[model samples]
Target: MESKALLNENSDLVLISGMCVAEVLTMQGVFTFSSMLPFFFEEWALDSIEAGWISGIYYGAYMISVMILVSLTDWLDAKKIYLAGALVTLFSCLGFATLVDGFWSAIIFRTLGGIGLAGTYMPGLKALSDRLSGKVRARATSFYTSSFGIGSALSFLIGGLIREWLPWQSAFWISASCALVAFIIVWKLLGNYPNTTGLRSGLRSLDFRPVLKNPKAMGWIACYTTHNYELFAFRSWIVAFLAFALTGSLGNLEIQPSTIVFIGVLLGMPSSVIGNELAMRYGRKLVVVSIMVLSAGFSVAVGSSVGLAAPLIIGLVLAYGCFVTGDSAAITT
Candidate 1:
């Protein structure tokens, strides 16, 4: 009975791995702009403020699209939203690869890409959650959550590696291919699960009054907001910060700033998975608060390390990156 029950719980392994891979693939183009920002700054003759908008608009679009589309998952099949988002991701990458020429065009496609991500990310998570329960569900969630870090690292590493031989646009083309593969995977492998909490007639799907009224939920929401602000800001600027800091010292380094960013983000995968385990064993509030405080201290130390040795600065950045991602799955769960 124990073995059979274990097998039953693990039967969704295909779905779990498929969704995780799809998530990773869908994220391929996310950091394309950030990884290639130096080239864009020169090619488009963009001022810092304009460049900031190009970076900022992606998240802005994501914020809006996720609120609506993820909310809709309560009523709609999450698989459908995931499919739509994957399609959008493919098109957005293709659009950016072939058509973007200047600042405005870049912004438009980045916004579209953001929307595509909004569709896949939470909706896909919802789909996965809807299909599983118990310890299997927790482990599956951690696996899925850890893929975001892998995807993020690949976003930087892939673009940087491609740009070594091919043009910058080639990275986007590859990213488009990844999205297409993700779309196909989900379309073929992910089956629709019934929404247990069916919406009642005349009631809104997105009504958040109850959520807002819950102080515990509200506290988590506030914490998540703060987490996102710092996380995104770090991702958006880490390469640039490294690039600027490494000026006159680039010749001495074996790795590029983008590679360092990749390594830093890659560290986040283990951090997230292990952090989730720790949160489960310890207390969530205790683990989260400790990680956040440690991350903030690292942030300060990194900022002050401008005149420090390159290796030391990079080490601090990697440590900071780990803590920055440590509490992610814990918070959401």
Candidate 2:
């Protein structure tokens, strides 16, 4: 009866939790960096690949920390880890605001922010999973993941506004404050749930041997990895690509580069839900493969046709963005 009551009450918790996750994730968009990358190229004396490294290092650090943080969820409560991660996010954003003048400094702080991401993302999902079971769990998970898309869109919008209107440092300061808000939300709402208090002793090794022995799971993992590589690469560079494409042609476009990126990302939220439904109707494997192929093909056209009309380039980007994120929930489940 108690559990049922809690489950009934959880709609609100899920809403708040999702929002908290969004706030934390939005911190990653400080200064609308992706949109600003082109500007930094000559100013910072950075080449393309070096600039890519500043972006890539975040995920690299995230990959390193996520295994440990998610592992700790088995022993420590997810909310506890989440709160700690929010702190890391807060400080990292602050660091970026004050410390970053060059590529190496940006890498250090962005990597720290990525660690904060490792803490909140999977662990927030874990926290949600631990609470809801059976039918409602699916909805909760979908809602939470979808919220990330919405949040990223909001970040682009907010960061663009701040960066355009004020000094770049102001955006990072606001982003750090967003992290603090995330911390407060999670900390205030979550108390220790039953069985969540047990502290498992010692470190548990992350053994991939068992999963590697299973070919089916390995295939899915491989597919998901490739899927993310393309998805993130497109996202990381899309705004800059659009801005570059608009050189001497800004008057021909309806939207600015950042706004286009925002719209592209925002539109993917429902597309993901719809794509999962389509996957169910057809098949997961079929839907995922088809989307990836289409996105890949479209992306090549986008790359080669940078000199095309701004609207055409933006349309291709929006289409690619939709397909890129469409299978997100399907792949996760």
Candidate 3:
């Protein structure tokens, strides 16, 4: 049986670890645009709104593609979807690195990157869940989900360091290389797991009536939508805001804005994993509400902290990052 093949603890550990690493590597380009926003502003002569469109278009493409790609997982092998996504990411990063010269080109490549993420992110999560059962599945879910923060943090840190040392295009090249490695890891290592659901006959029908009728599910969806809006908006603009901050007395600070953003994002991985554990112990609703309130309070504090000492501003933003991702795993679980 499928569960029999998964009975070995060592094999299970290896599967979980491989998927986590692939997920992290696949996200190498996820925030490359945010890290290099300052250079683009100067080179492209882009206004704030135009730059936002370039950055925001990634999510727009993701939203459209995720629905189609993840839904197909019911009929297709998730491993296939993941492999395709990794290849798409690799090529999209290459395109951005080699071909992008202005706003329209950046938007085109960023959109492709988003479609690539749509194929991997949730579908990869689903693949992991399908192979494991009970408590092991729950713990693996938290680990896999938290790894996203690791990927995002690395994108900011590595992209920033590369941009500082080499040309701006080098950052995308590095991101492309990571995606290529991710493709190899999954293609060579991940074993296929077939879907067991009996509803395979209705492949053409993607009826949403059942989900829409569930008040509890819809309520959670509403909350998650709001959470994502705030979190992504902060991520898309924080580096630019910090760069602006440096024009003041804080200009002499040793830490780069991208490094600070990296620290803040890296801090979120532990916050997400630990928060899910706490929710399992106490109660999901109570834990989620408390985390949301804390996140909101920190957001306000960070906004009010402009022009303060570098350390103080950095502290507030880092705290905000922690709270922003704290409830992610819990909410999804």
The positional error of residue 170 in candidate 2, measured at the CA in angstroms, is 0.9
Q: Locate the minimum summed-lDDT window of 10 residues in model 1.
A: 195-204
Backbone atom clashes (below 3 Å) for every candidate: 0, 0, 0
Residue 278 in candidate 1 has what lDDT? 94
Global CA lDDT computed for model 1: 0.88
lDDT (0-100) at residue 88 of candidate 3?
92
How do the residues 1-333 of candidate 3 rate in per-residue lDDT, one tens digit apiece?
A: 778766667778988999999999988899988987887899899999999999899988988888788887877778889889988999999999999999999999999999999989888988888878888888888899899899999998887898889988998898899888888988877778765654654364266677689999898988877787877788888899888865565655577789999999999889988989999999999999999999999998988877888778888999998999999889888
Q: Report how far off residue 138 is in candidate 2 (Å).
A: 1.3
**How do the residues 144-243 of candidate 1 rate in per-residue lDDT, one tens digit apiece?**
8889989999999987788777899999999999999998998888677776676772136688888889999899989988888888888888888888
For all candidates in order, the CA lDDT equals 0.88, 0.75, 0.87
Candidate 2 displacement at residue 82 in angstroms: 1.4
Say which candidate scores most in TM-score.
Answer: 1
Preferred candidate (lDDT higher): 1 or 2 = 1
Summarize candidate 2's per-residue lDDT along 1-333 as a digit string, tens digits.
999988777775655465546543545553256656766786689999888998888778887899789878877787788888889989998998899999999999988988988888778877767866874666566666676677777767776677678887777887887888777777776666555335434133255567789999899989878876786678778778887887877684466677888898888877777777777679989988888788789889889877887678778888877787887767775
RMSD of candidates 1 onward, in order: 1.6, 2.9, 2.4
The prediction achieving the highest lDDT against the true structure is 1
